[model samples]
Target: MDILAKERKLLELEKQVEALGNNEAVNKLKSEIEKYKHNEMTKLTAWDRVLLARHQKRPTALDFINYMSPDFIELHGDRLYSDDKSIVGGIGSINGVPFTIVAQQKGKDLENNLERNFAMPHPEGYRKALRLMEQAEKFKRPIITIIDTPGAYPGIGAEERGQGHAIAQNLLKMSEFSVPIISVVIGEGGSGGALALGVANKVLMLENAIYSILSPEGYASILWKDASLAPKAAEVMKLTAYDLEEFEIIDGIIKEPLGGAHYDKRETFKRTKQAIITEYNKLRRLSGTELQYRRTSKIRKFGFFQRFNYDNLGGIKR
Candidate 1:
């Protein structure tokens, strides 16, 4: 059975045990359920982590922002276009240290998701994020970006508004920012939408989060002509936190609760807050020049590859 199916079965048993109240059998049943849960969690595959990352109850960017900075005040608009609800930016403080916070905000349900455009940003969203980051640099406050988007919006309106240009501008500006910046991938970090806010001194991802150029289903559809093979595609894509960390693409990984972040949001928030603060403390010691240099240096090192001679294999020579 799948993880959710097993969880449902366990829930049913717990309900039955509750009816029998104060008995040794109930205690024994509870212990078995706990054991089962632990074993299943330990055996999770990459696809399972993907599902967990996209879990409905998983805490969103705003949830983490509010937990880390109770006094967070949201700012709106790209100053040129209307406000894009998909991306949120503002000022907040963590442990008395002020920061400019930017994040992709996903809604809790269908209605809210529609309002947020399913967290798929438009051109204005990236522009708003850039505006906020520029302000952060001017004020000398560290910037924290929470990434959790499948990708940027690809609708006709977004394209007409220059979605690609907006994302590219953010990338160019972020690399030159003279303030400390840290980005965290809390869930699905797909394509340039995520990378637009991801050029940071330190990049981190939750244990279960996935980051890649595209979604596994999209990859499967393009490569194998079958979207149903997403599970297999996930394995080959290596989009998991451990995989990215192994490749040295991500700086660090924050631990999640047993099942997922949604299982224990308070613990998840605590760990995320601690991780961000710890990374920021380290980056805070460096000068603005050093910070920009390190960030750009890190970006330049991506996509390293070795060249081989095709003549040796009886193939066309370069």
Candidate 2:
């Protein structure tokens, strides 16, 4: 019931997703989670959801990459600007099969946070991501991305380099990419910073992670001119896992450890590896034509959805 604790909430959510024995009891819980019925998630606050995404104990992209794959070959620089530490990618082998992974890392400590820019990609960061993704295409290797950022750095320098265009380019590039691509939002997938690396044949998110256009504080600041009501805004935004999943924006959910990825790294990593491998196996078995169809078909089916436009003034245009 204490959903404020990311770890505990994640464990409960994991139990909901996994195969809990006693069919009758499981069915009861399942029914309760269903929105059509009395959903327990109705109690969540917007800021609470955002906090879960940025929880101190949440697993970082690096943590997952370090354990999930071995002997990673990291690449750097945008070839246009300085290298951005926020984004790291290169040739890596998962289960001994070579592939390229683009992982966006958030800071775990003050020093690390400074280096990673709090996982906020600058224009160069996005450019670097774009460069590596091109490499994946050249080698005919599948692309896997881990998204974890509060959002792109919206500073004068970043804007000068065309941050919007950089993100747009990535979206266009990934959509038409020739190789299999899967993106997983491990935590705090915010705005264009996250979307720059988010396009994929299939997208996944951990149970406690949140993916949204903006963080609750930013949303609150813009809408209410007050950053204190982020929790209220989070509920309004519906940035949680079940919310996005039900909307069909993401393809699947990667169940985390009992308390969350941070709670049990080994267990969480195992589950993550299984999900990645399962998707890889499914994609790898198909022929070029089949893969192409599968890829396009998966995208063409997405709902371009419309929502009530909520601007800062409490004015929602219908």
Candidate 3:
């Protein structure tokens, strides 16, 4: 029921736009949406955007997987703890090229939410993902990961089971894997939860998807002692896909629909599929060793462009 209000207004907008048929009224709505969205979102704090990333109505990893992948056969269980419903893994074909798809799925509706634990995966969930990753590597299938989670599960039980270690292991495993792996952030990508699956050859983020170390609220709470300053924090943090791309932190940006992914998932999927298809072909040509080096260089380049002052030396030093 949380996203119900947004859904209702969205339907109204849809009907209104359809009847207006690209007329002034439809254009007005578009303008209004852009302004309102920018105004509200720009002011959001890190944690506020985190909430938006986890919005129930926002399209999930499963939605994109179903739209883009062919013959999805989901694999389950961590072989350590009971299967964490948050992460969905399996063998599938991306753009008809055989690939192993792994995605973080946020549940909608009561039953599914309970099943998915609100898209927060436990230690076993990550372990299961690693298992699938190794299996995919064995078959030489390029891995595709769909990221969407507000970080890993923070529950006491999850920590007790070595959650941080599992996430760290995933990052290390992904970095050294010979097979090509591509990750796209379709929705909320917070902290290590996103990074665990994000160490890849190409990292793509949807226009609206955010990738940040901490939510605006969390950052504000810790640094400023007030969560109300989240919007300011969001502005300073550069969590937007555009911002990340500008900094060369992510490889590409997958554009969304006119309004947002929450407004029209079909349009979002269309563009996302194109991005994946493009990357898949491009990376497939490279040798496994070459791919790893490229990936390594890409990640290492982040924040590498820092001050190289050589004023005292009187020459531009390398």
Which candidate ranks first by TM-score, i.e. highest? 1
Better of 2 and 3 by lDDT: 3
User: What is the C-alpha lDDT profile of model 1 across 1-318, one tens digit per residue?
Assistant: 655666578779779878888778788878988998889877878888888888898999999999999999999999998999999999999999999999999999999999999899999999999999999999899999999999999999999999999999999999999999999999999999999999999999999999999999999999999999998999999999999998889999999998889889999999999999999989999999999999999999998856677998999876
Best by lDDT: 1
lDDT of 3 at 57: 79
> Candidate 2: lDDT of 284?
81
Model 3 C-alpha lDDT per residue in residues 258-310, reported as the tens digit of each score = 44577678888899989988998899899989998998888888787777889
Q: Stretches of candidate 1 above 4 Å error?
A: 305-318
Output the lDDT of residue 242, model 1: 96
Residue 298 lDDT in model 1?
94
**Clashing residue pairs for model 3:** 43-231, 44-231, 45-216, 45-230, 45-231, 46-215, 46-216, 47-215, 47-216, 47-217
Per-residue lDDT value at 141 in model 3? 87
Error (Å) of candidate 3 at residue 72 is 0.3
Across 189-249, the per-residue lDDT of candidate 2 in tens digits comes to: 8988898888787788887789988778888899999998777778888898888889888
Candidate 3 TM-score to native: 0.84
Alpha-carbon lDDT, every model: 0.94, 0.80, 0.83
Q: How accurate is candidate 3 locally (lDDT)?
A: 0.83
